[model samples]
Each structure stands twice: as C-alpha cells, then as structure tokens.
Target chain A: MDTWEKLDIGLVMTVLGMGIVFLVLIFLSSLLGFFERLFGTRRSPAAQEPKPAAPAAAEEKPPPLPRPPSKPAPEPAPAAAAPAALRPAVVAAVMAAVSAYLQAEALALEPPVKRLPDDLSFWGRAARLDQMMARRL
Target chain B: MSIGESILRFLETMGFAAMTWQQAVMIGVACILIYLALKKGFEPLLLLPIGFGVLLGNLPLAGLMAPPVYETVIDPRTGQAVQEMKEVGGLIYYLYQGIKLGIYPPLIFLGVGAMTDFGPLIANPRSLLLGAAAQFGIFTTFIGALLLDFLPGISFSPQEAASIGIIGGADGPTAIYLTARLAPHLLGPVAVAAYSYMALVPLIQPPIMKLLTTKKEREVVMEELREVSRTERIVFPIVVTAAVSLILPAAAPLVGMLMLGNLLREAVSMQPILNRLLKTAQNELINIVTILLGVSVGATASGPLFLNPRTLGIILLGVFAFAVGTAGGVLLGKIMYRTSGGKVNPLIGSAGVSAVPMAARVSQTVGQQYNPSNFLLMHAMGPNVAGVIGSAVAAGVLLSMLG
Candidate 1:
C-alpha cells in the first residue's frame, strides 16, 4: 500500500479501535449498573441499617459511663498531659498496623471499614479519639 | 599442528576477537539497564533478567540464540528424504518459542487476573470510560508511527506501527503478545520500551496530569464506593469473558485466560479446591513465565537490529504514547468532573493507562499532594484495573485489523 492508503487505513483503525473500546466498556458499565440495581439493594439495607444504629448505641452508652471521671477527676491535669504526650505515638503505631493489615487482607476479605477516614480528616480523628477515650473508661 | 599454532587458533575463536563495536555498545546498554534495575530499583523482576539476556545475546561466540540446524537425509529402508536435526538450538531459542507461539503473555495475564481485585472496578463502572479513553494514546501513536514511514531509514509497516503503538498501553505482556503475532521483528525494542515506560510511570504521568487539571479538580475527594456483593463479583468474570469474547473473538485467548484466572480467584469462596489453583496462578506460574518471557524477549535485541533508527523511533514514540494516554484520560476526567459537578477527582483518570497499581499509586500521590485528606487509591484502582481490560480490547482491535 502507498503512503496515503496506509495513512487512510491508520485513520480508520484509530476511529474503529477507539469506538469499539468505548462501546465494550460502556456495555460493561451498564451491566455493572444493572447488577448493582439487582443485587446491591438486597444486601445494602441489611448491611447498612444496623451499622449506624450500633455506632449510635455505642455513642449513647459511652456518655453514661461514670467510672472515667471519678478516677481521673482528682488528677485531671496529669491525666490530660499524659495522654496528650502519648497520643501521637499511639495513633501513629495504630495507623501503621491498620494500613499494613488492610493491604495484606485487601484480596481476601471485605475491609472492616470502607474508608481510612480517621488519618485523612479532622472530624474522623476526633471521633476515633472519642471512641478510644470511651473504651478506656 | 604446532602447539603455538593451536593456541593461536583457539585465541581466534574467542568472543573478544569476534565482538563488534555494536556488540560492545549493546553490552554497555545492558550494563546500564542492570544498574537501573539493581541500584535504582526499576521493575527489577523483569529488567534484571532482560538485561542479562541482552548481555548473553551480544556475546559473539556464545550462539545462545542460534536456530536449530537441520540436514536433508535419506532413510535407508524407506528410501525417502527427511529432514534430520543436525544441531539443537540454544537455550533461549527454545524459550523464545513460548513467546513466538503466543503462550507466555496470556499466562501472565492469567496471573494478573488472579492477583487483581475487581471489586473497586465493579463498584464504579464509569471508570471504564477513563480506561477506554487512555487507549486513545495507542491509536494516536499508531498514526504517528505510520507517519514516520516518510522519514529516512525508519520505515514501519502498519503491523509494525500497531506493535509500536501498543507500548503506549503501558502493558508489557500485551505489547509482547501483540508484537510476537504481528511484528515479531520489532518485538525486542517494543517490549523494552513498553516495560521501561511502565517503570517510569510515576515520572511520566504526573506532569501531564498536573498540566491538564486545576488544583480544585485534583483535590476533589470522591465518596467511598458501595460494597460489591459476592455474587456480583463471581458473575463478573463470566459475563465479561462472554461479552468481550463474543464481541471480538480475536481477543479470546487473552480475555479467556484472564477471566479463567479471575474465576478461580473469585469462585474459591464456593469451591474450596479452586483456592489451590488461584494460589498457583498468582505466585508460582506467573513467576516462571515472567523469567522466561523477560530473558527470551531481551535475547531478541541483537546488536545489528536493535541499534538502529527504527529502535530510536520506537523509544521516542513510546514516551509520546504514554504522555498522550495520560493526557487523554485526564482530559476525559476533566469532562467527568464538569458533568459530575466537581465530584470526580480528575487525578484518578491518569491511572487509566494500565500500569496496574503503579499508575493508580501515582494518581494517589499526586492527589495527596494537592489535598492531604483526598484518598484516591481505591478510586484510582477502578480505572487502573479497567485499563487492563481496555488495553486487551485495544490489542484485539489491532489484531483483528492487522494480524
């Protein structure tokens, strides 16, 4: 084939190749969407509803605990200072372990939590700290 | 013969006496590749073996890549002429048959399929578009390579151009598979260029990604993906394999093997026996294929053929393909960002270039640079895995057209 003919074929290939790729993938996307509609709803309600309620219950029960204040009230300054000093190291260690475990377990299991929210956001960090404090109490 | 004459004849047979400047230069190139693999840690698993293969290939007297020698002989009883094997070929020549026969790449894809988690992809299927868009680089480079036929000493047939273009897919096995079928002559340079650029993805993709997107677009924190059900995951490989194979039968071997591996991985939850198969595919089988594929491919890079203007063109076009692919994905991402009202992070689009988790990680790193809280890894993985399917499809298209 001459240069122009080859170039024409090349252009045709360019269009045809890109067109087929898009078509196939778009088909796949819609198929996945269909699957989500079909199967996702079945599990989402059962999986999602209980999680928020359990966390909420945990939140409520933590506030009612009277043991935390009683033990630390007399030495509040030192108690606050000690945890403040130790918090960074502990959080860092925990984050490392969590990330390592998540990476190792990513193939086999669903993640325990969907997102690594704590390290990335201030509110998440605060919520985690609150949970830790409540657990200690 | 005198002792001195015998010694002198042995000296004349040595590799040093037969070595050319091109061979010397190729050896230097191999050493540099080895250094990059060892010291700088550039895709050490493949590059190290490939570099050593180049070294072995260039040694003039070694004959490591020699083809089998055959002679015509007459059978005494039958009185018919038959071809007799006079000498067996070299080790790598035998290993190279795996690539030449189109066996190794699909097997590698099987391992990749077994190892990959398609949950992220199934959750956000629109990322498939980004994967398809990145393939724009492959076709664009195809046109560019064809245009290079006008240049002096750099003629590329359409088959060669297609093979060269696949390097832009940033997928080493697919490149080799396509090249071995279409333009076996260009296999060495194309494979080298493909793997080298894949290793350099972090360096190549970011600048284009940054250039294409705004600061706000890069920092867009995407919502967490919905949970994919076990049934959905299991059905995925089957459906995809059926759809893609029916649509493009030429892609069956690759897509078929890939889905089979994935089926093994995902179906283990139901059939416990499949776990053994999945483990083998993911680890041992892949490792053996990788070594053979790397060394045999590198052995094809003989001094005379490799040190040429065409090889240089392939190397240059490789980077061009990667740049355009990154740009293509990022541009599509920009469109998605606008359409989604800034919900989509455009940075994740660059991961569409099929370097597996490496491209995805680059997206994450670049996104984190702009916004500390932005977690694009899982989001980017959607496109990252999608790119594999996209490239395989692109290869199918080219093969149907050219092969």
Candidate 2:
C-alpha cells in the first residue's frame, strides 16, 4: 500500500486540530467566568435604589393644583376680561381690589333708601374671603 | 531595413508578441473576477485589485511581478564569488515581500481588532466552543487533500496541505499568512479561495445551517446578554494577549497584534491623539495594505500556475472546509441546545465558521425566517468573534508543526 493509503494523517489532523481548538476556546470561556468571579459585579443604574426617591419630603407633599375663580361679581361685567397671561395670584388680587372699589362706588352712587338692611355683612364677608385667599396663595 | 525585419520589430512591442495561450486565459479569468467584483459584488475591495493585478501580471513583457535576479560579484579579499540579488524588482514583486515575510496579515489583524466589538463574546463566553468547533472544516479538508493525491497534477505535501486547509477558516489574512509561509507558490489560489468563500458566507452557510438545525431549535429565544462591565472589556484583550502568547508563541504575532488593536480601541485612559493615530491604522493603513496585498497575491496567479489541477483541488477543498466547518458548528450548537434544555439556538453554531459579522448576520436572517421576533445577531456574534481567535490558534498550530 502507498504511504498515503497506509497513513490516516487526515483523520489524525482532523481529530487533533479540532480537539486543540476546542480545548483552547473552552479554556478561554472558563477564564471569562474566572475573571467575572475575581472582579465583583458592577451595579447598573436600574439595579440601584431609585436614588432615595428624590428627597423624601418633596415626594410626600405635592404642589397645590390651581383653583377656578369664584362667581364673577355682578356689577355690569367688564367688556374685556383681564389678559390671561397674568399669574393666578395677581389676577385674584386685581379682581378683589376691583370688586371692593366697585362696591364702595355703588354705595356712594345708589339711593340711600334702596340699600338693604345690614349691608355691613357684605364688607365683613369680603374681609373673610380675603383672609381665605391669602392662606391658599 | 528589410520589410520582414521591420514587421518583426514592430510586433515585439505589442502585448500579443510574447503572450501565451495560458496567459490569455488568465486575463479572461481576471476579467471575470473584475466583473464579479463590480457587478456581482463579490468581495469587491480585494477582488477588484486582485483581478487588475492578474491582468497586469499576465501582460507580455509588463515585468510587474518578475522574479529577483542575482548578479555574481568577485570578492577581492576572499577571491570568491559572492552573489548579490537585486533588491528591487517590479511593483507587485516589491509588494509581495510583505506577504512573503508574513508582515501584512498580522497588521491587518490589528485593524480588525480595533474595529471589532467583543461584548457579545464576553457576555456569553460559551460561544468560544462553537468558534472552536467550526474549525473542523480545516482539518477535514487537510485529510481530503491527502486522499485526493491519486489524481494527476494534484499532489500536496503535508505543508501544502496545511496551507489549503486554512482556507476553510474563511479568514483571508490567516490563509495568506499560512500559504505564504508553508507553500508560497500557492498563495494566490489560497487567498482568492479564502476571500471568495468569506464573501459567500451568507449563501454557503444557510443551507448547512438549516439542514443541521430543527425548526424548534431555530426558534429558541435566548436571554438578553448581561451588561458587561467596562473594566471587563478593557481587561479582555490584555488577558487574552498574555495567556495566548505565553501558551502559543507561534500565535503571538497575530494574536498579540489583534489584542493590541482591541486594547488601543477600548482603553479609556488612552490619549485622544494616540487613539486617533491608532484609528488611522484601523482605517487608512488597513485599506492601503489590503490593496497592496490583494494585487500582489493576484499577480502570483499567472497562467501555468493557476490553471493547474492542484489549484482546482485547493478550491474544491476550500469549499469542503467551509461546509464541514458550518456543519461542525451546527452540530456543537445542537449539543449545547439539548444540554441547555433548548435555550441555545443551533443557528448560531454556523457563525462559528468565523466570517465575522456576515456569518452572524446569516444566523440572524435564518432565525428570523422561522421566528421574526428572535434576535440572534448579538448572541451569534459571541461565537463569530470567537471563530477569529480559534482560527488564529489553529494557524499557529499548523505553522508550528509544518513550518
């Protein structure tokens, strides 16, 4: 038989070559695991506590929602409403000042006989509304 | 001058004057390769240059890749003849020295390393085994080459056999490196075969991948890769370099350069200027070297050498190597799949053949065909990159034994 026929070099190489490569890679895979164990895991942002919930007191108390304005006082309603751009507090203050002024003007202009009994309640009620608005603001 | 003499003189300067039938055939082959590169888009980057080089080399009296000549010099002191070979020859001849000295391949590996991402491999290290398994093609082809010796004009020594076997690795540089060292004459066919197969990865790998895997195995959904630490990514190349170089010194140049490129790319502390310089190596240097290497390699495939039966044998064996490699990876993948209780998708095993992103992409495409939701690209990359290392190690082994 020829040397090529007699020897199974191909078979030998196949086994030997594949075997060596597999073993080396297997070693590398194991090395990766070993490295991971040696170096402790690095924590991801998601894994950490949600940053202590952004200062606990801020979380417990929410900001107050805006309230609708009370029924518009009935003198002849102004033709043009105040611009909507103003801050809520400024708008409320302006409306109160205007209401008080208008009520005083009406008291001066209206006939004394037509004035209702105990009109002092109107002033007292307005004062109470001012106090409530101040606390809310 | 006589009319006949004038005609002969005129004919001498033309390409056809000295061109052989075989040379003409090689030019045709070159044209075909060029067409494949431009139209078919078959590894155009390397094939285009190679095809042009083939045309340049085979042209009569072009002298682009002629052999170096030695001149006899009389030494006065010893009164003896000292031969001095011409240092420079043709352009392609000069470029071929890079391949001959085994320099270009390692440098190319550096570029590859800089560009490649090893996160997938790091995320799931078990993919290394699949990478290793895919190399089964190389050895099987080696055996097949030896068996085919009975055919006329197709004889290979163990060294040539080793060179041919590496083409199955589907890595162009590794094939060129091994062939240039072990069988320099065979470099052209081996390189062309290797790159051609690499380009054909999508077409070649899928059929074998599907045959070896089942529908259920293909549909297997793998868990998301864990977040690999930056420290681990940084340490990986360094650790691999130290370990592989120490163990296999023959592999040091290829492996060390690859790791160095990766380290240069990944290091957080590296200066921006230096990193940019390394990036130039990854982009510009690699492109230039690739052009030079491809053309030089193609120049070696002149008529008589390339048209031989041995070249055919090598090409055939190359395909065999790729097929067997794909099969080997899938088989191993099947084993892992069964062992892991069906968590592992066998399609990823085909990526072990090491065409890099292409092989991994083939895995993704095939897996998606079965189940569109399955994202195997990242998972497949683990083994894909692993195949690069595995083949380099295999090349080291072959060089140590045969070289």
Candidate 3:
C-alpha cells in the first residue's frame, strides 16, 4: 500500500485502541472517587484548602493591638538590630509569617472573641497564628 | 529453488519487498509489542495494538497492504468496510500516515500538559536554571552525532544531528516529532530508544543520582512550597505558550497544545465545566494519541531498512545521549549545592534532565535513603518541571537552526 493509506489505517487502529484504555482509566478514577464519597475515606494531596472564612476575618481584621505590644516584644527588636546581610528578605518574611501565625492562634481560643469591643485587630492576628501553628499538628 | 530461496522468490515475484525469513521475524517481533502492551502492561496502552497492526502488514499474500506489485486484495477479514480491501493498502501504511503528517505527536503533547504541574517550578525559579543546565546533553549529543560523519550512510548535518540527539532527553513524543521533522530516516531507532530508556528511568537514574550526590547532600530537607495563587497558575501556561510560539513557530503546535491543557487545569473558576468536559470527552485524549503514536512509530520499522547498521548506531547514540544528560544535571547540581552551601540539595540537580516527575521522585527517594526524615519531593519537583520547559525551549532553538 501507499504511505498515506498505510498511515491512515495505523492511526485509526491506534487511536481507537488507546481511547478505550484511557476511558477505562477515567472510569476507574471516578469510581474510586465515588467510593471515597460513600464508604471510603480519601486523602487529597492539597493542603490548607479551607482557611476558615470567619477565622480568616480575624486574621485580616486585627494587627494593631498585637502590633503595639509586639513592638515591645524583645525578638522583633533584636531583628531591628541585626545587619542587613543577616536578615534577608526571606528570613524577614519567615519571621513575620511565624509571628502572624502565632497571632492568629491566639485569637481562635474557646471564647471565640465574643464581645471584646468593636476593634478586634489583635484577636484576628491571634486567630491566623492559631491556624499556622495548627498546620504543624 | 531451495525451500528458503523458493519462499524468497515467491515473495519477490509477489512484490512482498522483503525476504520471507525477514518478514516472519518482524512479524514475530510485532507480536512481542502486542504482548508487552496487553499482558505485561509495559506501555501496553500504546504498544499492544501497534504490534498487531504491524504484524498484519508484514503477512504474505494478505494484501492487507498494497504489496506494490499487484493492486490486489485477498480476503484478510477483520470485516470492517475498509477491510473489504477494494485495492491494496497495508495496515502499516495507515499507521504510518499519522506520524508523517505530524498529527499524533502534538495531540500526545496535549495529554502531557494535562498531566504536568508547573507550580513547583514557579515556587522555585532557581530550578529553571537546573532544567536549562540538563539540556547540555541534547546539544552535546548533536555534536557527537555530527562527528560521526566519518561513518558511511550515517552522517547528520546540524539539523539532523539536533533532531537525533533529542533521544537522550527521554521524551518519546517530542523526540518523534522532532525527528519526523528534521531527520525522518532516523525516526524508528530514535523513538524506540526514547521510550525504552524512559521506561528504564527508574533503573538508570538512581545509580547516577547515588554516585553524584554525597549522602549528606541527599538528606537536605527543603522548605515546603508556599501557596501559589490560582491567578498565577492560570497565567503561566498562556505566558509560556505565547512567548515560545513567537520565537519559534515550528515548536508552536506541540508546545501550544501542552500549554493550553495546563491552562485548562489551572483556570479553577472553570474547573466544574472543564472537569465535566474532560470526563465526557477530552481525558481519553491521552490513551488514544499514545496508541496512534506508538503504532505509527512501529509501522515505520520495515525489515531490511529497520535492521540496518544506522539503526544500531542510533541505539548506541541514544544511550550516550541519556547518560550525558544525566551527568550534566548531576554535576551542575553538585555545583549549586556547593555554591549555596548546605542550603541546596545536590540530588535535585540530577532531576534537571526533563524526565518529568519521575526523575524528581528518584532524587527524593535517594535523599530519603541518606536521611530518612529528609523530604525533597517538592524541591526536586522544581527542577523536574523546569526540565520539561527547558527541553521544550532547547527543542525550539534547534528547530530554528535546522528546520
């Protein structure tokens, strides 16, 4: 047979066959997902997907109260003294992230910041810090 | 005529084009591909039926093909209308067409994009440099193959050399697409080598990864990846595809398809629609193209031509290319480790050769052996994904020079 004719046959056969196999795979994955939804428990690969929308509010809303206090906390003060080379952007970001996570944790206590006045900025930072620390667990 | 010569003369007179012995042997070999695909599941998703189609073409008097001598078809009944065999067209003829037209290879790239994750690379942009470093093997092999100008019937100009050297990257579809474009003659051996060695990545990479990385370096635990925004993921593939296509039009089809698949995935706002569409329609796109691509590759392996000395040279060169790519990644990884001083893990360097997540997994696995607590998967993935982009870029560069 000519080259084109030969290629056409091969293409049809291959696509058809492989298509069947791929469908089987998707079918299986869906079935697996279905089973997980029913009787089985499935662990997804992604982490930190649900950031507790209310807690996130606490995170975004409050920082100034903890801020003036953290202003006096000895650690952020030492960072102020360190040389620029010693405290790179990454290191600073990491420190802030840790501090932020700690502040978030402080806000998520059992009381849930009920009636702590209109300004709950400190409580929000404490809540975010709680989530960050909880991530380790 | 003796039994052998009589069989040969009959086949020659019949215009079968190959000696009966050679035809029989190739037919048997085709059966093996089918077995590997169907039973052993060694890339059976692609190989199994490709093998059967190849066997059908090589059979005597079947006229499952246009035997070149007579425009005739005896009843070789699979009973499809096309199987009624009005004239002559071999099974191989049909399979070969998709490859020559550059159809199946690009579609295969679409599936790859759907499977890949560029998040790791973006999270660690330095890994992009590692991916670029690994591409040294591709160019190095090009020079190596070109230097083989001393061999008869086996010389490669710059473009042909670039095309052939890509076998070392261990990316089957890309290698096929490039060779089909730049050096069609070398396509058969090159594709075979690319697939086989890629399957062997689990076997090949660990040793090199072990040799190059000191145990202490392997155990370096990397910081976890920070969250990448959905917006960034959506933008990445589009940016890469548009940037690459503008520079090298030849690579656009394959690269463009891959990037689109990635975009489809990361556009989370459209996830429900995409998930439904993928489930109902496009997800199987992966298997279908693999089967078509595999058989098309196999159909090109005609007996005398397929068994020639040049094919053997390619097999040898393919191994050389794979090794060189691995070494380049490992050596550079070590350099980065030293330069970064304990902060960088040298094992990640070996993942730069674009075998995708497989190479990265090996880096992580080896790292675990040194320090059981060392977790390098996320870090290794950075270079692994970058290797994919790097190889694609390198491919574009070569096509411009040669195509």
Candidate 4:
C-alpha cells in the first residue's frame, strides 16, 4: 500500500490495538480477583469469632483464684497432668524410642521441658538466605 | 621480475585496491561501534561482537557472506541427481539463518522468561493497563513512519513501518521477532535501533518521566504489595498463555516460549536436574545465543544497506517511539494517581515501556532523586513485566492485521 493508505491503516490499528490491550487486562484483573476470593485461605470473620470464645470458656473453670507462686505452679501441672491422663510409661516409652532412633543415651533422651516458640520471622529470614545463596551460586 | 612489475602486481591484489568507498565507510562505522562498546560501555556484550562482525563482513574479497551457488550432484542415499547448494559463505552467514528463519527471538524469549518474575504483576494486576498504555508508541510511530514517505528516499511500506514501530516496545526480542517476520531486509537497522534504545533506557526514559511527573507525584510512596501465593504465581503463565493463544494464535511462538520458560523457573519443586537445566538456559544458553544473534545481525548491515536515509530514519523514529511510549505510560499513571487518591507513584509509569529491569531501575532512580526513602523498584516491576506481554500482544495484533 501507498504511504497515505498505510498511515490510515496504522491509525486504525493504534486505537484498536490499545483498546483491546486495556480490555483484556481489565478482564484478567477481574478474573484473577475472583479466583483469589474463591480459593482464599482466610476464614470469614463471623466463622472465626465463635471459635476463640469456646476455648476461653473451657479454660475459665481452673482460674477461680490467682496467687503469684500458685500461677507458676499451675502452669507445670497441665504438662504433668497431660502425661498422667495417658497410659502409664507410654510417654517415656515414646521418648525412649525417639532416643533410640537418634542413637543417644537413655538419660540424654529426656525431652527438654522448655518449649521454644517456632518463630515465623526466623523461617522467613532463613528462606531469604537460601534464595540469596542460590542466586549467588 | 622488475621492481615496478612486482609493485604493480602487489597493489592489484591488495584488499585496499578491492575495497569500495561504501565498504570503507562501513568499516569506519564498525570502528565507532567498537569504540562505543569499549569506551562508553554501551551494551558491550552484544555491541562488541556486532562491531567485529560488521568489520569482518565489510572486508572485500573475503567471501565471508558470499551467496552460495548450487550444483547438480548424484546423491548416494537417494540414488538420484539432485541440485545441492554447497556451503560457500562463512560462519556468520550460516548463523544469520537462525535470525532469518525466526528462530533466535523465540529462543531468546525463553531465556528472558526464565530470568523474569511475574510476582509483581500478579500482586498488582492493574499495572497491566499501564503496560498496555505504554504501547502507544508502537502505533504512534507506525503512523509517523508511514508519513515519513513525504521526505526524500524515506518511504516505508506497511510492513517496514510495522517493523520500525515495534522499536517503541523497548524490548529486543519482540522487536527482532516482528522485524524478522515482516521486513527481513530491514533487520539490521531495526534490531540495532531496538537494542541501542534499550541500552539507553536509563538516559532516555528519565527526562520524559520527569517532564510528565511532578516532584510530589514522584515522591508518592505506594502501599506495600500483598504477597502473591505460589499457586497464583504458577497459574499466571498458564492462564496468560491459554488466553493469548486463543485470541491471537500468531503470537503463540513468542508468547508460548516465554510462558514455558516461566513455568520452568516456577517449577522449582519439579526436580533438581530440571532446576539446573532451567538455570543453564537462563545463563549459559542465553549468553551463547546472544553472541551468535548479535554477530549475525551485524553482518547484514553491509555498506549499501545500512548507510541509507531509511536506516537513519528508523533510528530517529526508534528514539521517538520510546519517548512517546514513556509519555503515554506516565500520563496513565497520572490518571491512576488522581483516581486512587494519590496512592500511586507516577514515576513507575515510565517502567511501562518494558526494557525489563533496566526501565524499572530507571523508575526507582528517578523516584529516589525526588525522595530517597521512597522505593519504587518492586512497584515499577509490575508495569515492567506487563510491558513485555503488552508488546508481544501488540506484535501479534500487527502480524494478524498486516502479515
């Protein structure tokens, strides 16, 4: 085609091309948002609100009175009571099996009573470190 | 032999005697490219090899890019007389075949996809509109290219104009892909302009961005993007590919290969061997392909073809297209800024021109100049990646309409 004819064609294309691009992207954005809402891991606020209260209600019977040293004493009782509820020596046997699997001494296999919180921030940092190492390699 | 006779014989056989004025001029151009690569550090990876290739191609009587001649030969396997085209040209000519047959650009897209991350785009999907807006340059330049016929020795057909217009995309593979398909003869200049402008993104985009944006707008800090899930990241490429494939099947190769590479990158849990292969494709394979593609494209710019008015026009139009694309993106960003109650930074609009990390980095740099604490790199990356898909879609449109 001649230059003028071609120029006209180009003008038509610019409008149509840009328009389609915007339309497609808008559609995609809406569709993606729809998918996200459909498959989201978050529970509704109404569903979650009922759950926390139930746990709190069951724990209230043990705390009619509060004394300073007694508070600390009651904390260990839960752990000690949990084992008592189970079969006799079952907890110890489980620990013994773990120790055997680890190939450690029987006394050394006594699980630490002190529980450490699994820090999410620490895991995030570790993941970032791994990514950085991979990139460097 | 007499002394005069010996001197005459040597002079007749020397390269200087055989070299035309055009070839000499091309050699000078090649030298300038080499200087740019070495001294100025302008895309040295590609430019150095390209400059060297130009020199080698321009050497008269070297037969480096001589057309092969066919001869009838009896084939042992077929037991018949067949016309066989002997390999008469040099290595660069054979390498050029990859570009001619439209092989290199798609392969390059694979590497680009492997390196790219779609998280930014997925986190802020609205940036896709900005990416589409940046393509205003390609169409605007198409009109400009066609209108340039009013000037002497500067007529571009629809095909040529389409090829030239894509330089606005600020993407090397997309530009090369379109040019190779539509205007193969114009490949050298189109490829060079696209790459040169891409390398100059830091310099070319900032002024336009600043002109279009205010100091306050540049300093606007965007809210942190929500973290995209792994499932969303994995689904993105597949969805885009399926969508584009259904709409514009012509773009299937460029878009498909790009998505394939991204799938490989995101499929980290597939296997260690597969991950290693993906890494190799991103680094080693891309590096090797780039060297070959650069040199081959350079070899095509022989003196007669490259020294014309059309080549110069294409280069000028390329920069203009880039500037226009930047402006278009920034304008859209301004609109979004006003609509969103000033939550968006207009500086990231320039990243919509899609030179990948380079344009995004330019956005970050310009934004930082206004406000040091305002980090726009991650935000700009959204439009940066969207620009890639936008340009590919634009190419597909042009191909379908004009191919």
Of the candidates shown, which would achieve the greatest DockQ relative to the real structure?
Answer: 1
Clashes of each: 0, 0, 34, 0
**Per-residue lDDT for B384 in model 1?**
91
DockQ of each: 0.38, 0.20, 0.02, 0.18
Candidate 1 chain B weakest ten by summed lDDT: B367-376
Alpha-carbon deviation at B252 in model 1, angstroms: 1.1
Better of 1 and 2 by lDDT: 1
Would you list the clashing residue pairs of candidate 1?
A: none
B116-195 per-residue lDDT for model 1 (tens digits)? 99999999999999999999999999999999877799988999999999998999889999999999988878988888
B1-403 in candidate 3: lDDT tens per residue? 5899988777676635644776777788787767766776555555664576567656766655343334344545654333333355666566667777888777777777777777776555567667766666676677666666467776556556677778866677778888888887666567766766666676777887787777777777665665555665676677667766775576687778888777766764656778654442246877777776776676666567566667766777877777777877788788878888767888887787777667787777778678765667778888887666666666666665567
lDDT of each: 0.88, 0.83, 0.65, 0.82
Candidates' chain A TM-scores: 0.38, 0.30, 0.31, 0.30
**Candidate 2 Cα outliers beyond 4 Å, as residue runs:** A1-7, A40-137, B1-7, B75-80, B84-88, B268-270
Q: Write model 2 residue lDDT over B1-403, tens digit each, in one string.
A: 9999999999998888889999999999999989989998899988998888888888888888977788999889999999888654788888889999999999899989988889889878999999999988888888787777789877888888899999888888888888999999888788778888888988888889888888899999887677777778888999998888777788888888888888877773555666785778689988998988889899999888899999999988989999999999999999999999998999999999888788998898899889976778899999999999999999988887778
**Which residues of candidate 4, in runs, are more than 4 Å off?**
A1-3, A38-137, B1-14, B72-81
What TM-score quantifies how close candidate 1 is to the native fold?
A: 0.86
lDDT score of model 2? 0.83
TM-score values for chain B across all models: 0.98, 0.95, 0.84, 0.94
